[model samples]
Target: MTLLAFLGVALLVVLAGSRVAFYGDALAEKRGWGRTWVGLILVAATTSLPELITGSSAAFQGLVDIAVGDVLGSTLFNLFILSLLDAVSGRVPLLGRLHPGHALALGFSLLFLALQGAALWWGGPLLGPVSWYAPAAFFLYLLAARLTFLYEKRRSLGQEERLARLYEHLEAAQVVRGYLLWGGLVVAGASFLPSLAERLAEETGLGAGFVGTAFVGAVTSLPEVVVTLSAARLGAFDLAAGNLLGSNTLLC
Candidate 1:
């Protein structure tokens, strides 16, 4: 029953997640924000709902290790999904077509990881009630977002008029509504996953850390996997790659 329920929820998430990718692409076109920007900020945040909810719940319950493991594991799992996307992308290569601005995002992700490692090694908070690294990471994320936005803006110059026509048949309001509606469904379905994961972990007799890292993390990242593939299939490769890379950075 547990396994069946897990699979069922996963299926729903996958279906909703695919819709999210299409709507996200539409939103990007309607807004002329570029696929990379939309994927990084919008789609990534929406798909990351599971990790956010699960980690917060675990942290509230004082399961610090589970929370931390879930974040770190989800980040790793998201990166793994990128490799999967590459493999399935065929002859042209998915990474080959990505915008160079993504390298900036990757650099920030690495910096965030290193900060996390330093925090772990220190074994104590450098700031009141939270590690200094937490705020530092947040600051760096803001900076990275700003820089990437500018970079994408410059690269997308004179292209907005062309991009806008891509979704001319649909109203901007309609696209936004569809994106939010599917995104909300994705979030709703994903929110229940953490409890289901915990139950399955108990039934399987797995340790908390292992279950959190492997089972919970992978389950939570199902949205990313489905959404990325959907974007790739739609020929929105930038959106696909941005979703994965941005998701890792967001989780970290």
Candidate 2:
């Protein structure tokens, strides 16, 4: 029953996430937002909702191991999804199509991961109840976003008018309504994750880190996988890769 419940909830998360990707893509096009920026800022944020909620809740309860493990595990899992993309993306390498600017995301993810790992080993806080590592990670994330924005802007400079006209047919009210509707479903499904992880840990006599890495990590990442594959199928390769890498950066 526990495993069944996990699968059921995961499916819901995926469905909600696919809708999010669809509307998010349309909204971005409507607003003249770059695919990379939209994937990083908008779509990535929505898909990462589950991990953010679960990780925050775990941290609030002082389950630091679970929080850290889930974040790191999710990052690794998201990167692994790239391999899956490679398998499905024939002929041209998926990476070959991506803008070189994505190196910002990759670099930042590694930096944040290093910071977190070092914090665990160094064992002290630089601020009240918060480690020195936290602020560094946060700042790096901001820097990465800004850099990606500039790069995307430069790359898409000539296409501004074209991009703006692309989605003029979409009604704002309908798009917003769809975003909210699907987002609500995502929250509903994701809200069950932390408790599910706790229960799985208790039932299996597993450590928080192990359960977080192996089970919770995989389950929570369903949304990203679903969205990425769907995006690829639609030939939105940049959005697909950006969403995955962006989510990994946020997860860290």
Candidate 3:
């Protein structure tokens, strides 16, 4: 029964995510936001939502290694996803338009790993006193954005912006209906899903933490791969490269 409920909730998360992606692609079309930027800034984050949940829970539960390992390992996989995007794009030369800014993302990602390493080492066995590592990740996000601006300015590349899908499915009535209503549904759903995942570990001896950290983690990360490959296949190398690498930098 527990596993059954979890499966149902998992189905909902996937369904909600698919709706979000469809509306998101349409939203991008209406606004003239190029596919790459929309995938990076909006789509990537939404798909990574499961990671944020599991990673945060692991961190909050003092499973620092699990939290750190998941991000680190997932990032390596993200790189694999990028390499796959480049390979499948068949955009010739393979190194074609491999944006210098993406190199910057790799550098930032290295720095993030360094910080996480230092925090865990210096903070002792618990890795909690250095919980500031989480917030510090945001500062790194700011730095990435700043570097992006500089990169584009140097190369004369224009700043890109995408349309908000909120304008569509979301309405004034929905907004006025209050956070307690829709927000509650989202939160309830959120709370329901992860706990269901947790329950799987409890009942099945499969270790929810590991399943959530890995199996589910890989599942959630797929949308980025799909969008990215689609963009790359279209010969949008820089945009595809930028979305994956840039998102890795921000999320890490």
Candidate 4:
């Protein structure tokens, strides 16, 4: 029954998360923010909210193992999903269509991971609530975002008037409606994760890290899988790739 409940809740998350792609795509078109920006930050962040919630809640409850495991496991699992997306992409190669800005994101992500690893290896000092890695990661994330913004700006030159018109015609009301409706559902579904993961860990006699990496990790990431596959099905390759890559990068 517990396992079934886990599956049921995971399904809800997927359903709620899948709709994010549709609304995100529409917002990108209406705002002319382009797929890179929407997929990397907006849609990715929204879909990844479950992890944010799960991690924070687990930490608050003193389940540091689960919190750390979920982040690491989800990052790897998200990358694995990219391979699955490639398989189902039909004639077009999914990775071939991605923007070059993703390289910067990947680089920054690796650098952050390396910092965490170094801290772990050498036992780096803490900064109150977290280790030194925390603030460092934030700074690197900011730099990554800035670099991406500049890259997009350079690539989209001379389209200011068109972008202005796109902005003028933006469907603010409907977009907010969609985000609120789906976003609420996502939050509701995600809220169940911490307790469920704890129960599952206890029932299975697995370490929190192992269970978090295997079960909770996959469960929370179902949203990304659903959204990415849905985007791929519709030939929204950039959005699809960006969502996965961005989610993976942010997982650190």
Candidate 5:
């Protein structure tokens, strides 16, 4: 296929992936989860699912260069997402709240990169935290999720819950079913994403890292980019901006 054709396919993947993530968030919301919970955990994880799947697949396929490229691409693209959020929100100061989940995620993201570098220097495929790191990170992620959920629940129950008056074009049942269905789709779609990326990178001769960061990264981040834009258009400013900041934390 032509480079243009490959680009088109990648774009389509991002669009589909974005919708899938929105479905997941909508499902969580329909289940009585507040916006923060939906944005932070549900939407955030689902949105980033593309990256994880692609990276793991590349590594498994012995496309280590592709794997590294995709991670770097995801990081760059995720930052672009953050910059868009900043421009849209006009400096709402997401970091000022000192949210524990954000803090933890930021810390882990840095540690993830730093340790991975150290591992490479020492001739390892992976890095620190021993054999227990993934599980430990998972545990911490869960705890942070619980705390965020509680915070949102309490916030909505109080005077802090204020809608941006931007609700539009929603289906209750469809959204409700989204959680499980979208999650499954992410697993399946992500499975294909990296291979697609690998082919595209090799075909274009653009180098694995750059292509992965721009193409794969943008493709995986499709959800947040679209959602944030939609939120801005619909006047759900907080949700739009929140999704950006929240997604960035997860990406990191």
Candidate 6:
């Protein structure tokens, strides 16, 4: 029953999450936003909702290790999705097709990962109860976003115009509505994951860290897997790559 419940909720996340990328693409087209930027900030955030909600739930339940493991494991899984994207893309190299701006996102992800590792090693409260790295990660993420925005803006002029519009029929309002609706569904489905994961860990007699990293993390990352593969299939390599790399940075 536990495994079945987990798979069912995961399926819900996948269905709702897949629509999020399309809506996000449409919203970007309507707003003249860069696809990479949209993939990074908008689509990636929606797809990563499971990780955020599950981690928060785990933390609130005093499963601190699970929370940390989920974040780290999710980030790792997001990166692995890139290889899957490459496999499905065919002929052309996936990395070769991506925008140069993705390097910036990759660097930030590494920095964030390093920071997380250091925090875990140096454990303790910096701001009363909050870890010192929390504020640092938040500020660094802001800085990464700022730089990415500027980079995308500079290169996006002629670049975006060449891509075909998949959602030309949808109005801006409609796109926003669809994105919000699906995003809410993703949130609803993800909220149940942590408790299910905890129960699974107990029943299976697996260590919390192992269950969190392997089982919980993989389930939470289903959205990313779906979004990246869908984007790749649509010939939106930048969006595909951005979603994976951006998700890693965001998980930090």
CA RMSD for every model? 2.3, 3.1, 6.5, 3.8, 5.1, 2.8
lDDT (C-alpha) at residue 247 in model 5: 58
Question: Regarding TM-score, does 1 or 5 come out ahead?
Answer: 1
Tens digit of lDDT per residue, candidate 3, span 126-242? 446547776787788777666655554444323222223324555534433432242233334545665566556667766645664465556545545654665565555665665
Candidate with more favorable, higher lDDT: 3 or 4: 4
Which segments of candidate 4 are over 4 A away from where they belong?
1-8, 155-170, 197-213
lDDT for predicted candidate 4 compared with the true structure = 0.73
TM-score of each candidate? 0.90, 0.83, 0.62, 0.81, 0.65, 0.86
Q: Per-residue CA lDDT of candidate 1, range 1-252, in tens?
A: 987998788788989999999999888777767788888888999889889888888999999987988898888888878888776677987768788878887888888888888888886656878778788889888897888777777765556677667778899999999998989988888888877887888788873565445776677887888999999888788888888778878888
Candidate 6: where is the Cα deviation over 4 Å?
1-7, 123-125, 194-213
lDDT of 4 by residue, 100-184 (tens): 7677766776887788779778877877867887787778777777776667665554444544454465477787688668867
Candidate 2 residue 251 C-alpha distance from true site, Å: 2.3
- The candidate that wins on lDDT is 1
Q: Which residue pairs show backbone clashes in model 4? A: none
Residues 1-252 of candidate 5 have per-residue lDDT tens digits of 555655665565455555654554454445556655676666666656667776777789989886777666676665566556545554565344223444444454565556555555665433563443445445655666676666556544332323312123556776666555645554555555555665676677754565445665565665557665654444344445445545544543
Q: Predictions ranked by lDDT, top down?
A: 1, 6, 2, 4, 3, 5
How many steric overlaps are in each model, in order?
0, 0, 0, 0, 1, 0
What lDDT does model 3 reach?
Answer: 0.58
Which candidate comes out best when scored by TM-score? 1
Model 5 residue 14 CA deviation (Å) reads: 5.3
Worst 10 residues of 1 by lDDT: 207-216
Q: lDDT score, residue 137, model 2?
A: 76
Error at 52, model 1, angstroms: 1.8
Which 10-residue span in candidate 3 carries the lowest summed lDDT? 157-166
Cα lDDT tens digits, model 6, 91-183, are 888888888989988898899999888888987678987989989999998898888878877765455565434566677898899989987
Model 5 Cα shift for residue 154 (angstroms): 1.3
TM accuracy, model 4? 0.81
* TM-score of candidate 2 on Cα atoms, chains taken together: 0.83
